[model samples]
Target: MKIGVALPQMAPGYGPGTTVDWARRIDAGPFSSVSVGERVTFSNPEMVATLGACAAVTERVQVLANLFVLPQHPVAMVAQQIGTLDQLSNGRLEVAVGVGGREHDYRSLGAEFKGRHQQLDDKVAELKALLAGEPPFEGADPVGPACVQPGGPIILAGALGPKAMRRAARWADGISGFSVRGDAEEIVKVGELADQCWAEAGRTTTPRKVNGCFTALGVPDASEALHSFVARYLGFLGPKLAEMIAASARASTPEVLAEILDGAEQAGCDEFILVPAVTDLKFVDVAAEVVAARS
Candidate 1:
């Protein structure tokens, strides 16, 4: 299985230069992809713009929007932005869409929170239609410049349940999943269910299985830092749950992370994206050293 690194965009006080530097470092490192996640009501760097900068600086690694809350934005506009991002990355962009669980984020953006799943299903279709160069409306001109990829970039869904799995089977090229502690069994179960959904839908091909986990590395008191960051990032989920998530983050030391990597590979993860709990770029170097030794 290939290994990827999530940019430190979500780290507190992280900025544009740091985002670009992280991308550059990932390009120079042994990672296969550089990814960023979305959150409108947070202090983190904006996902789309930061990804654009990453695309501008890196030539080889894949640029993934880990989870774009599709229900929070206009469909055609997002299609245009994603198409432009794919063009900027020379067809290296991979998108993952979902209806995020945060009602606060939707409220902050003035987007409706209810019926988001249905809205996401509609928006996904609309995004594909727009990317395909179909007119945005009955009598409107098509959006441009067309994607560098013939059919646009591959689309993945952050789907974890049966209903979401069924929807993904219909349109998504894959599913991007997560386990806070790098639990191989949990990830494998999710992958099997996604495959089952595809088979039930009569699809001959199986969905790509991508997994993610949180960690803290190369910093003093790494575990503490990891827990603190997780607590803050998921504070909206309530203190008890946030603390629980913080407590469950995988250890980022080489020995522990190597075990996690082996477990993910054995569990059928085609790509494993490691999300750092701390903002420091040293985490990348530490992760690289571990991954290189394993490779």
Candidate 2:
């Protein structure tokens, strides 16, 4: 499986300096992609802007938007941004769009959550058309800054539920899934359902299989560091829920991380995005070492 790393945008106090180092290191190391995620009302950097910066700096690694909450943005605007990013990265950009579950984020963005799933299905179709160089209206001009990737960059569904998977099978080229508990069984279950869904959708080829997890390593007390960092990042979920999530993050040691890698691979992950909880550059080196050893 191809391995990737995430910019520590969610880590408290991590900013442009750390992002640059992480982006360059991920591109130069034993990694196939560099990823970033979205959170509108949180401390994390905006997804498109951080990815735009990443695309500008890196030359080799695929730049992945681990997800964008689709219904929150205008479809035409989303198409334009993806087109620009695809061209900016020389066709290295891939995106995952989902109906985000965070209702508060929707309220902050002036978007509605009800009917969002249907809205996403509609928007994905519109995004595909716009990226294919089709004009929004019958007489309007097609959005330009043409994507380097023919038919634009590959799109993945940032989904966890079967209903979401069914909707995505209709348009997405792949799936972008996260393992909240970082368990291999989760990967296997998602993979099985994806295959079934795609088959039910009458797809001819295998949909791309990708998974992501959090890690807290390259520190003196890695486990504690991971829990603290996770709790901080997830503070939006309220203290009890955040603490519960942080406690479940187990990729603190090389052995533990290696186990996840092995399990993901065995479970058929084509790409595994490793999101680092620590901001130290050592985190990249250490994670790379783990991936290499597993390879």
Candidate 3:
């Protein structure tokens, strides 16, 4: 399994520079990739632009948008940006896209929130066509610099529901697991369903699966750390954040975290990205220990 670090783009008080520094630090360390999450109206900076800066500074680390909100942007424009980034990074770009669930974010962007699943599916198809060097629109110029790879950068669809998983199998190169809620049974079920969908689509090869989780290191108490972390970073979840905070608290210890990761690997996860719950770089230190042990 490959270990990656998620750059802190939405911490409580950190700025965009913090994300850059985190990317540089992770690249200098033993990580294979660095990821940034997307949030339009939230506190986080633009994912692709932040990652573009990271791509400029790093020579070896793979750059990823853990999941870009597909409903917020046009598919053609996203394809062009991703293709350019892939060329600029020498084929090191991997894009994970999903239909964002925040109603307020959609309202702010003036994008239709209903039927976003279908929109995401259509967008992914359009992106694939564009990356394959097809023209964005009928008489437009062909989108090129043509991705460093033959087709394009790896496209992973972030799917957390059954229908979305099937859509991922149909259109994306892989399915990103964002539904694991610290339950081993649920995690296994997610992997099983993903594999089933891929197979049902007549895909013989296993689709890549990526899992992500949040962590806070150097905290004396797991529950307190989890609560504080969610209260600050996941305020968008409303009151439900408290329940999620508690669930995450159960897996806070290093040993338990390792087991959780190992379970994911056993269930067919190809990569795991760890998001540090705290703003301090110390979580990276703890994550390094976890990676060393697991790898």
Candidate 4:
């Protein structure tokens, strides 16, 4: 399976130079892709800027936005930005789009939180049009360069539910999912659901499958480290907290991580993105070890 690393966008004490350095390090490693997350709040770096930096410095590694909030931004602008980035990167851009869930983020962005699913569907349709080199709107000329690749960058829909899965199969080139607590079963379930949705859509071509797992590496004890990590990261999701906490308690070792990766690969995941739970940059070294051992 291909390996990817989450850009150190949220790493503690991170700055532009440190972020660039980490990108370079990961690019020099065995990773096939480097990804960044979108969060207007918290300490996370801006997704596009971080990705632009990585693209500028790396030659071979694919640059991805693990997910961008589609409903909060104008579809035309997003398409243009992604097209430009894809051109700049020589066609190595992959995007995962989603209807963001955080109410506070929507409020902050002056976006209506209601009917987000419908908005996402519309935005994706428009984006596809723009990426296809269609005019931005009636009576308006196409705004930017056609995407670098034919039919534009690989579009991966970030999905969780049955409805989202169906939409992904219909509109996206692939599906991207986060494995809560690094659970192999959850990863497999996501792949199965996506595959089922694709089959239901009567799609003959197999869509790409990407799975991400967040884990704290280099801690003194894996279980304690994962417990603390989940309490902070997963607990913030409220209702999902108990389930994530339970999963963490059940599996929290390098051996478990290996098993998760193996199972994810067996379950038809095309790519795996790993996020180091700690903010320390040293966690990258630990991540490197895990990637090497698994490889």
Candidate 5:
């Protein structure tokens, strides 16, 4: 299994300095990818800018927009930005598109929250066609600065449920799944569901299976740190729900993280990315240690 780390763009206290430094560290480590997730309504830096920073500095790892909220942005704009990032990464870009669960984010972006599922289903098709060099309309030129990857970056569905997986099989090369509790059984179940959904979609290729876990390591009171991070991140859901979700976070210490990695690989993850609660550079080194031991 390949290992990846997320730039702490969304964590509290994150800044451009941490973003650049973390990107360099991840690039220099035994890591396969550097990921940044999206959320426009929050304090996090914009996904494209953060990912652009990673791409500009990194040479060895794939740069991922791990969960680009598709419905919140114009499709044509997304195609252009992704195409540029794909080139910027020298063909080492992967995109995971999803209709994120946050309604407030969509509202704040001036994007309609309703019918987002349908919007996403339609936009994915449009994005693919645009990336494939199809003109937006007759007599109109195709978007320029074409992708470095011949067919464009590998598209992943940032999906978790049966309905989303079914929609994904038609367009996505894989699912960028996340386990809220770092559950191996959950990841295994997701792989099974992906297979079932793909076959039902009449797809010939097996979907690439990958999973991610939010972790809190290399910190004193790691468990509390993880809980605090999750609570803050998921605070939009209400204090009750946020606390419930935060308390359930599974991986906090190095030992717990090691087990989660083992379980994900055994659960058939082709790649596993870390979402860290803290931006301390020690997190990267410790993760490298754990991954190296497993490897």
Candidate 6:
């Protein structure tokens, strides 16, 4: 299985220099990809823009948008932006589009919270068509400067449940899954669901499977930082529930992290993106050493 890391863009105390430094280290490390996830009501930089910068600095690692909350932005604009990022990355881009669960983010952006499922279903098709150089359904001329990837970036669905996996069967190249609790069984179940969904859709090609988990290793106050970050990140879910989620993010030790990695690989994960909770660069070095030892 390939190993990847999340660009620490969403971690608290993140800044431009930290992000750039992270990108450079990831590029030089034994990592396969550098992924960025989006959250509108957060301390992170904008996903697409940060990815553009990452693409510029790193020539080897794949630049991935782990989840671009689709319904929050205009479809045409998203198409153009991703197409441009694809070009900027020289075909090294991978996109995982999803209707995120954050209602507050939608409200803040004036995007419709309800009916997002339908909007996402529609927009995925539109985005694909636009990337393929087809005239948009909106009767607008094709958006261009064309992607470096022939069919645009490999499109994946950021799926959290069966319904989302079903939707992925229709358009996505694969599923970008997250295991919030770092549970191997959960990741395996998700892979089974994706397989079942794809077969039900009569798809001959197996869906690509990628999973991510939050980690905080070899850092000062690692557990506290992990819990604090998770609580703040998922705070919208209510303090009690957020705490519950935070408590589950306990991969602060190399032993635990290795088990999670081994289990995920056994679970049929093709790639695992490790999301870091702390901003310390030492975490990267420690993570790389651990991963190298495993390799």
The TM-scores of all predictions, comma-separated, are 0.98, 0.97, 0.91, 0.91, 0.98, 0.97
Model 3 lDDT per residue over 1-295, tens place: 7878887666665774687677778888778898888777777788888888888888888998788889778777788788788877888999899987788888887889999998888888888898888997789998766888778878888886788898888878886665324455666777788889999999888888787676666456754665576665556677676556546544467787787778767766788777766667776777778878875
Ranking by TM-score: 5, 1, 6, 2, 3, 4
lDDT of 2 by residue, 53-158 (tens): 8999999999999898899998889898998999889999989889887888999989998999999999999989999999999999999878999988889998
Error of 4 at 113 (Å): 0.9
- Span of 10 residues, lowest total lDDT, candidate 4: 243-252
Error of 4 at 29 (Å): 0.7
Question: How many clashes in each structure?
Answer: 0, 0, 0, 0, 0, 0
lDDT of 4 by residue, 127-185 (tens): 98888888987899986877778878888999978899998888888898887655677
Error of 4 at 89 (Å): 1.4
| Every candidate's lDDT | 0.89, 0.89, 0.77, 0.79, 0.90, 0.89
Candidate 1: misplaced stretches above 4 Å? none
| Winning candidate number (lDDT) | 5
Q: How would you encode candidate 6's per-residue C-alpha lDDT over 195-258 as one tens digit per residue?
A: 9999999999999999989898868888888888888888889999999999899788888899
10 residues in a row with least lDDT, candidate 3: 178-187
**Model 2 residue pairs with clashes:** none
Q: For residues 102-181, could you state the per-residue lDDT of candidate 1 as single tens digits?
A: 99899999999999989999999999988989989899998887999986788899999999899889989999999888
For candidate 3, the TM-score is 0.91
User: lDDT per residue, candidate 5, 1-295, as tens digits?
Assistant: 9989998776778865898899999999999999999997788998998899899999999999988899999888899999999988999999999999999899889999999888999999999999999988899898867999986899999888998888888889999999979899999999999999999999999999879988987878888888999999999999999999999897888899999988999999999999999888888988889988887
* Model 2 whole-model lDDT (C-alpha atoms): 0.89
Per-model C-alpha RMSD: 1.0, 1.2, 2.1, 2.4, 0.9, 1.2
For model 5, the stretches where C-alpha displacement exceeds 4 angstroms are none
Model 2 regions more than 4 Å off: none
- Candidate 4, pairs of clashing residues: none
TM match of model 6 to true structure: 0.97
- Candidate 4 has a TM-score of 0.91
